[model samples]
Target: MLTISAWKRFLIWVVIATGLIFALPNGFYTRVERHNDALAEIEQLGATPARQEAVAAWPNWMPATLVNLGLDLRGGAHLLAEVNVTEVYADRLDGMWPEVRDALRDARDQVGTIRRIESDPDVLALRISQPENMARALEIVRALAQPVVTLTGAGARDIVVAGENDVITVRLTEQEQAATDDRTMKQSVEIIRRRVDEVGTREPTIQRQGADRILIQVPGIGSAGELKELIGTTAQLTFHPVVGRTADAAQRPGARQVIYPSIDEPGVFYIMEQTPVVTGEELVDAQPSFDQNGRPAVSFRFNPSGARKFGDYTAENIGSPFAIVLDEEVISAPVIQSHIPGGSGIITGQFGVEESTNLAVLLRAGALPAGMTFLEERTIGPELGQDSINAGRIASIVAFSGVLVFMALSYGLFGIFANIALILNVGLLFGLLSMIGATLTLPGIAGIVLTIGMAVDANVLVFERIREELKTARGPARAIELGYEKALSAIVDANITTFIISVILFTLGSGPVRGFSITLGLGIMTSVFTAIFVTRLFVVMWFERRRPKTIEV
Candidate 1:
């Protein structure tokens, strides 16, 4: 009566074989990793002879997916950075100056001549020549205010306008500021993630810590300094119409004008409009290429909206110099010879090939919404990671060996069958991990060790029930059948509860805790299958062949 159907037995062995095959790559981690990296490079940059040889290191027909190592196991760079969200307020005010000027000019007869005055970075102050027209100026500026677009900021205006005497000031409201801070934080996290992904590092964690702080952990990077260099550059590129060139650093520009020194020329500065014709935010693509003179450069293309604005600006400003600014410095001021219809352009400066390539990468990833100041930085060395791995390896082996010895001593032939199933259970766990591309941390290793011990509980339960069942007059087959049937409910109940806890941990926790939960959840599924199906199948096969009238579990 205790028997597995032919199809069921076939299905069980097939699953076991597939799992072991998928898990085989981890046995040769170094070679398989090189093969994977080489394949990625070939897909991205085309193949070289060396890359082809590396790809051949692993056969194409075999499974190549690997379980990623977490930062704790692989060593990496960690950084805590605080974003300068307030900086966007100044930029917002600067951009609003043109609209404010246009609105007030429409009422020039009432407000008289308007001029910008020196004020705080967060405020836009305007002075009118007519003292009695202050109310009129305030009304015009207040009319330009729009409702904030965020859900919590409903019914709140984005800008607040106030006036005293002949001066009117405009600044963002409190609700608007809060909304802007939220947007800034989200954008910063995404941009940082994009930059890290561009470098192809494994399993980097980029998450917001608090209101204006971010936490970054990148595995397999050389140092925190290297990671900072990769993501730190603002790479804020803009094009503005040049007002004039000057060498006097102390010279003040009129309203709506800014001065920036040339990057290549010493002591030379260019005064330019504060408003840009187009910004890097509108860029859709950028690539490293050679300019007309065969010098290294970065070629960029804009989205549709940006293309129209760029084309119109170039068409109207022929023969005028346009300054290309990067991070408040003028990279070049080239004269527009004719109307350029296309949205594509090249940035030429003092750049090497590597510089151009890196620039292209940054441009494609988009500029950070605001600047960041690093608060804490640390680099974990690989030697520490190797020691951790060695310790985990020893722990897993000890746990596995101890479990095998105990099971063999207690239950004779049935114990041996349980031991075999336990080994397969571990193999199946690793296979599932590889298939899902889960990251393995030190805590994850501990979870696997715990799983090895827990794997035998179901077998022990079934074997004990069989021992009691043998006391009756019923034969070995009936006792075995009843033992498995009776123990099924307890096995499912216990494992299901633990699996739910693992799911909760994964949902609520982060970093190493998540790694542990993933391994534990997977181990539960694999262990249950081996204990119930695999061990039972082994016993049934032996009984069918030998047909022993008397048996001992």
Candidate 2:
């Protein structure tokens, strides 16, 4: 008999119900989106009357997951930025200065006096008073060279040291530069992702394009310029010892001192020591809070090592002004009133609540490894996205309606069963997408249209086989059973090959290609299930009830 067991029949309906339930939220996308947003805000900021009303827009018992709309379908900001990895070379050489100076100082009896010379940003040049001792200085600097950590750079020293006529120059080796560039790009991508996530945007695409370029696509952002402002701030915070205050911007701060303008005060600058006591890299946490004066401020805590250094510096430098520098500008230069032992500090400045909150976010996300130059930027409008959505909906409807009509006409009653299965197949596809939190793009819609066409292939094969079996004078039940058994191998073989291709596409492709692959891959699984199991179940149930003596294809 072509009857499904009780457990199998029950399982099939349960699956179909679950899929439809999960997919239900998409039908009321706006209401459910508002509900989800309200819920998240309630969890983060506590509920208000407006938020509570929004939350009540959708029922709490239903599945709240909705497929994330891609950049093309939702409108967003797009940017292609080239990271200045070479900037790190200058910072690396500057950090190496103290070590180099200390090493050369050990041989001062032979080397005489050494002074750092103004040179190219990537090169650290030093002039020694004694010309003949240059060999000794070179040896000391070369001894400080560490082996590069990368696979291709193994056994190679990170720095190249050379001397000529009393001047010694140091620079990063080519292999080390390559390794540093790679690290810089990876760090840039991660930091950009964190900054964008801080804004609570959905499914952002922050990916590396080439060697030093990054592509960022953020859905629902106002503009590319706004996005650039959010991620471009380096937020390089450092606690430097203030040398003196200055009014003249052109004032020359002697060697090893930098002059930075005060952020809040006009026409005032602070001369700061080049070496910082602590940097934002040591910061463990930062949050927006009110200072003692009840003004908006950012509160920060340092890690243990930073805490120790900060505590010692404050303890010794009481009554002296300490420069709180961000991106080379002194934001605050407050006198150390007393020893602060706990490593916690508040940054008070001319800021509103929003500015303080954004500052806290930037500090928490950490500084970008280097600066980036925007190579390309674009802002897509929601009106354009809505147009794309309307076009895709029309295309999908046309395809779906055409498929339903064609299937019904060709296979008669069996074709109606196939059409019902095809409908369920689309529902199941959306259910899977919602469950996985997949982003749906325009190409993904095309995949759905393709799936609707392919969904009836198995049913067509089975019905044609049954037509052949009926001609052999086989009983209706036996013919239906043999038809499914014969069609099973062909269905699995065809879908399996296509599924493998989708997997490969997903593995290698990015952006829209990835979106298409995800939908196609999921569509294949649902289509096969509906075509074989779902349509067969409908046929068996109808036949069992009607007890048809003869059936027409």
Candidate 3:
């Protein structure tokens, strides 16, 4: 039997646990009282009741309740995207391989080519079959290729004649080269984050997985379907010459104006072109809504230099046309209506919500940092998440009940007492979760349920220790003390090992797995507290009431 001191220790432990678990998210009776004085003051100035209602409905005054829901429970879009370095390299080969082309051209010019010349940005392959001319060809090609990538497909005339026509593909070392790996994946993650934020997703969690992937979680998303539409669009932008829109417009026989190609209208059109000498990069900000005349329009502000340049350009070409060319298509080429020298202008078009959103996404992410391609995407519905939550709750109830019944039957009154500790252990777990403001995903709830079974393991250790000691002829008080002392090492070592694994998991695991580890870690500490104090106190009190004690654990 535990002494009076033992009972006091148990009660203090319980009280401490309750305070941490229960009294935290808000104080015991603390309410979030909203101050309405500002609203009342605003109402005093309101011109009409309708206007006051609009002011009251603004999100700034309301504290939004944003709960993080599990991927399965809350329903969301899951996407997997891979960086295609092959395509990037291919593009480099197509547009920027001037050195390779020049090498082939110079090789041809020097060697007097009778065959074909095919050169990509990264590789130059040709069929200079004349044996006498091959030596000069290799020398010219060797002089031009970047170091570590030179004259690969080379050999004797016999080797060439047998099967090899001059065809060589150059590749760089993995670390020294650009490819779809962790670094590229991380870049893609940042770009995607920028894109999602451009669409106004607050508090999005975007992260990279390995060398070639990203995981994104967007909470309280309203534009999920729009996200699906945009997943694979590689809308990277760069500044190119406006190609003399003013000249084109002045040359135009009619008043049709030029514009650029974008999601708003992705096709070229013939207009009186008045191309701005400056490109879109000069734009500092874009606001979308109805124009002064109530038509959908985008208002753009320019940098200081851009403003001055705009003023100068418009001043010079007062009667000229300026075209807004995007992706090589003109959306609108309104005649430079009296020169927008202020550097700010409006893009008025037949735009709806979808087109406006796409335009906003473009202006916000700032012409994509690089091109992207989607390699994976999955849409999750809320129904699936609801089903999973329902199943988890049922399983928890069944698992918890089984634990209570087994502990009670096996240990009699002592088992029943441990059962109460078990109940308190679970209550404290949720209370802690609620207090910490931690999200309870389905996996997290299951982790708590599993913790219940493990919680009893510590008490079972103590109970069996006492039974063993009493059987060995110790007095009740001595047996109880020895039992607790002997059980301490085993209990701690076991829980500590489990807790270590949980820590490792929380550090290394992703998403839901981390949730499991977090709850498991919390469980270990709480289980030890409940087992050491409450169970021992119950045994001590029971001995005082019954007075006879001898049993097999």
Tell me how many clashing residue pairs each candidate has.
0, 0, 22
**lDDT of candidate model 3 versus the reference:** 0.61
Please give the range of 10 consecutive residues that has the lowest summed lDDT in model 1.
131-140
- Put down candidate 2 lDDT per residue, 1-553, tens digits, no spaces: 7999999999999999999999999999999999999999999889999999999999898999999998899999999999999999998898899889998888999898889998999999999999887787788899999999899998999999988998999999999999999999999999999999988999999999889999999999999999999999999999999999989999999888999999889899999888798989899999999988899999999999999999999999999999999889888999999999989999988989999999999999999989999999999999999998999999999999999999999999999999999999999999999999999999999888888888888888899999999999999999999999998899899999999999999999988988889999999999999988999999999999999999998
In model 3, how large is the Cα lDDT of residue 22?
58
TM-scores of the candidates are: 0.95, 0.96, 0.62
Better of 1 and 3 by TM-score: 1
lDDT of each: 0.93, 0.93, 0.61
Worst 10 residues of 2 by lDDT: 131-140
Q: lDDT score of model 2?
A: 0.93
lDDT of 2 at 259: 96
lDDT of 3 at 332: 62
State the lDDT of candidate 1 residue by residue for 1-553, as single tens digits.
8889999999999999999999999999999999999999999999999999999999999999999998888999999999999999988898898899998888999989988988999999989999797877888899999999899999999999998888888999999999999999999999999999998999898988879999999999999999999999998999999999999999998677899999889899999988898999999999999998999999999999889989999899899999999889998899998877779999999989999999999999999989999999999999989999999999999999999999999998999999999999999999999999999999999999989989999999999999889998789999999999999999999999999999999998887888899999999999999999999999999999999998987
Rate residue 398 of model 1 by lDDT: 98
**Which parts of model 3 have CA positions greater than 4 angstroms off?**
1-67, 86-176, 179-183, 194-210, 215-226, 230-239, 244-348, 352-358, 365-372, 431-445, 472-478, 533-553
